[model samples]
Target chain A: MSLADLHFFKMTREPSLDALCAVVAERHAQGLATILYAGGTDWMVEQEMRAPLHDEPPLVVDIGRMGELRGISLAGDSLRIGAGTTYLELERSAVVQARAPMLVRMAKDVGAVQIQARGTLGGNLATASPAADGVAALAAYDATIVVKSARGERRIAMADLQTGYKKSTRAADEIIVAVELAPPPEGSPWYWRKVGARRAQAISKVALAGVAVVENGTATRFGVGMVSVAPVTARMATTRALVLGKALAEITAEEIDHAVDQDVTPIDDVRSTGEYRSHVARALTRDLLRQLGARV
Target chain B: MKISLTLNGAPRELDSAPLVRLLDALRGPLGLTGTKEGCGEGECGSCTVLLDGDPVNACLVPIGQCEGRAITTVEGLGEMAHLSPLQRCFIDEGGAQCGICTPGMLISAEALLRRVPDPDEPTIREALAGNLCRCTGYQRIVESVRRAAELLREGAAR
Candidate 1:
C-alpha cells in the first residue's frame, strides 16, 4: 500500500449548501462513501492516501466552495456560525468575539496561524476529536449542531453529537450546516483553558470551559464543559448542580473536586495519564469557579 | 479533476487529481518549486501560500478546493531581478540559513505586513508562529520581518 496506489476518482465542488446536501444524498444512495471536505487542512487525507484501496475510493466533495456556509452572523439572539467558517474567521469575527469570547480564545489557541487559517469549525465538529477545542467551548454555550441531508435538516445538541473519539452521531448522508448558539445572559463570566504539549499545534491533554452568572454574590447559573477528560465534550452537570444557587463564598474547593470526579470519567491515553487529567480537571474547575465567583 | 485558479497573478488552468495536495500540484504540474515541503503536514508551514489574501498551508490544501481562488506562492512575491522587500530583508538580516523555511516565512510575513504594515514584535512573532526556522534561532527571522516592514513602508513613502 502506497500513496501512489490510492485513486481519487472524483472531487466535486458544490456551489451551494443545498447542492452539497443533494450530492451527498445521491452518493450515499449509490453506495459510494462520501466525505465532506472543507479547507483540506486535515491530515486524514494523507493517511487515507497512504492506505491501499481495496475497492473504489471514497468520493471527496469540497464543500468549502459553498457560499452559504462561509461566515459568522448573529440573528435574533442566536449566533449562527456557518459550517465552513475557518478558525481564523472564528477568531476575527466580531459577532463571535462579542457574544462568545471564549470561542474566539479557543479558536486562536487551536493551532498555529496556518492551522487557524485553514482548519474549520465544521471540520473539527465532524471529525469529533475528543480534544477538539471548538467543541469544548461550544459546549459551554449549549450549542446545537445543525445538519442537513436531502431528506431534511436536524439539530443535535453538542452534548449528544459525539458518540466516541473521532466519531460523530451525524448520519453519512448529512452535512453539518451551521452551529447555533444562544447568547448567555448579561454579564456572565466565561473562561477557557487547554493544557497541551505546547502552546500551539498540540492536541489537548485536557481542556475545560466554564461559564457562570453571578448576581448578588450568589451563582445564578453555571455551565462547565470539558474535553480529553471524557469520551465526549460533556457538560459538568454535577458541578453545575452543586454550584448553582450557592453563595460565591459558600462554594468550596472540595465541592469542585467532588463534582469533577463525578462529571468527568477520564481514561489513560498516550497523551496523558488518567490521574493527571483528573487532577488538572479538578484544579482548573476550582480555579475558574473561584475566579468567576470573585468577579461577581 | 481539473482546476482553474489564479496562480502567481496569472490565470492558470491545470489538470490534477481532486484530492492531490496543492503542494504536489505546485511542485508537480504548476512547475513552481520555490515552495518547500518540510513536514508535509500542516504543522511546519513550509508549504505556506496565500489563498485569496490569507496565509494557508499549501500541503494541506487540496487543489480542487482552490478553484477560482487566487494563490500567491513565494515565487509570486519577487524574482532574481527584483526581490520583494521581505525577500530582500531576509537576505540582509540573515533570515535564511538552510533556506527551507524562507519561502513560507516570507509568505506569512507578507500576509502580516499587508494587514499590519508596522506590527509590533508580538504581532510579528504571532504571524510567523506557523513557520519554523531551525537555523536562525527565530530572533533573526523576527528581525527580518520587522526590517521588511520598515523597508516596505519606506518604499511606499517614496
Candidate 2:
C-alpha cells in the first residue's frame, strides 16, 4: 500500500552522463521494473506505481542527483533545456520566455505554484498525457525530445514521440535527458489557452496553442495545435492549410470552423464529452485565428 | 535508508526509506504533525512546506530528494508562546475554521510574504492558488495574508 515495500532505491548523482545511463541499463538487464525518479512522482504514484508482485516495490533510480541534467541553455538555433528543470524554473527563465512565451504561459497554467515548482517537462513528455499543458505547448513549438541510453543518444520529434494514451516509445533502458526547442521566428504572435473544470489544479478539458506570423496582410507562417481533443497533441493540418499563406481578408470563419471539425477527433471521457470538446475545439480555433487575423 | 536534512532550522537525521513521503517523515519519525495530509494526493495543499525556501507539496516529495535541503514546516513559523505575525493575523482575521487547513494556509502565506511584502489582492490569490480552503471561503484567508504582509513590512521598518 505504501513505499515501505520498495526493495531498491538508488540515487544517481554521477557527473558523467554515461555513468547514469549505464546504471539504468544494468538495472533493466536484471529484469527489474525501473522508474527514473524525478520530481513529478505525484501522477506516477497514482497511475504507474503498481508492483508486478504486490509484495515488492519497483526500482526507482533518483536521477535528480545527476547535476549535469539541470540547466537551461541556448545551443545554436534551439533552446537546450535539461530534463530536470522544473516548471517553476521554466516560468522564471527569461531566455525561455523571450524565445517561447507560449511555453511560459502554459507552464504557469500547468498546476498551481506548488505543482509548477516540482513538475518537469520531461515527465510530461514521458507520461504522454493528451491533456498535459507542457506537452501541448511543446507540440505547438515542434520541440525535440532528447533521450539517452547506455548505447548512445537519439532525438524524437514531440509529435512522433507518444504512441498512445498513457504510453510512449521510450525504452526501459533509456531516460529522457532534455528537450530541444527551436525558437519561433522573433516576434511571432502566439496564443495559448486551457479550458478546465476550475481556475486552478484542474485538468484540461480542452487546450489550444496557436502561432502565426502575418506580414503585408498575408500569413507567412501559422500553426494551430490542440490537446485533450485527440489521441495525441496534434497540429490542425486542415486548419493550417486553409489559413497559411492566405491573405487575412480572404479566409472565411466557416472554413476555419470546418477545418477544426475535420482535423481533430476527440472521444468522450470523464472530464468532457466528445461533442463539447469538438464544439470548443472549433470555437477556440476560430477565435485564435480571428485574433491573428486582426494583427495582420 | 538514512535520511538527513535541515528541519525547522535544525539539522536532524532519521532512518526512513528514500521513497517515503516527506509528509510521513515529518509526521511520523520527526513528530512534526503540524503538516496535515488532507488528500494523500497533491491536490489539497494541506501538506504544504517550504523546501529550500520554495513552497512545495510535502505529500509528493520523497524524503530522499530533501537530503541537505532546508525544510520549513508550520512549526518553524511560530508556536503557542511566540506566535508568528502571520499566525496572529490569522487569528485576528478569523482565518482558522475547522483548523485542518490553517497550518498549510499559514505556511503558504508565510512563503508569499517572504517574497513579496506588499502584494496586491490578485498577487496574494495567485501565490495561494495551491492551498485550498473549503471553510473560510478564502476571503478571510486573503485578508490575513494582507495583514501579515503589513506586519512584516512594519517589523522590518523598526
Maximum-DockQ candidate: 1
Badly placed stretches (over 4 Å) of model 1 are: A5-7, A43-50, A185-187, A294-296
* CAPRI classification of candidate 2: medium
Candidate 2: global Cα-lDDT?
0.82
**Tens digits of per-residue lDDT for model 2, A181-226:** 8787777889898999987788999999876778887777776668
lDDT per residue (tens digit) for residues B1-158 in model 1: 66899999999998887777788889989999999988877888899999999998887787888889999999999989999989998999999999999999999999999999999999998888888888889999999999999988998999
RMSD for all candidates, in order, please: 2.1, 2.2
DockQ of each: 0.61, 0.58
What lDDT score goes with residue B130 in model 2?
Answer: 87
Q: What's the lDDT for all of these models?
A: 0.83, 0.82
Give stretches of model 2 more than 4 Å off.
A1-15, A47-55, A294-296
lDDT of 2 at A292: 76
Give one digit per residue, the lDDT tens place, for model 1 in A206-262: 888877777887777677789888887767889888788577778777777898899
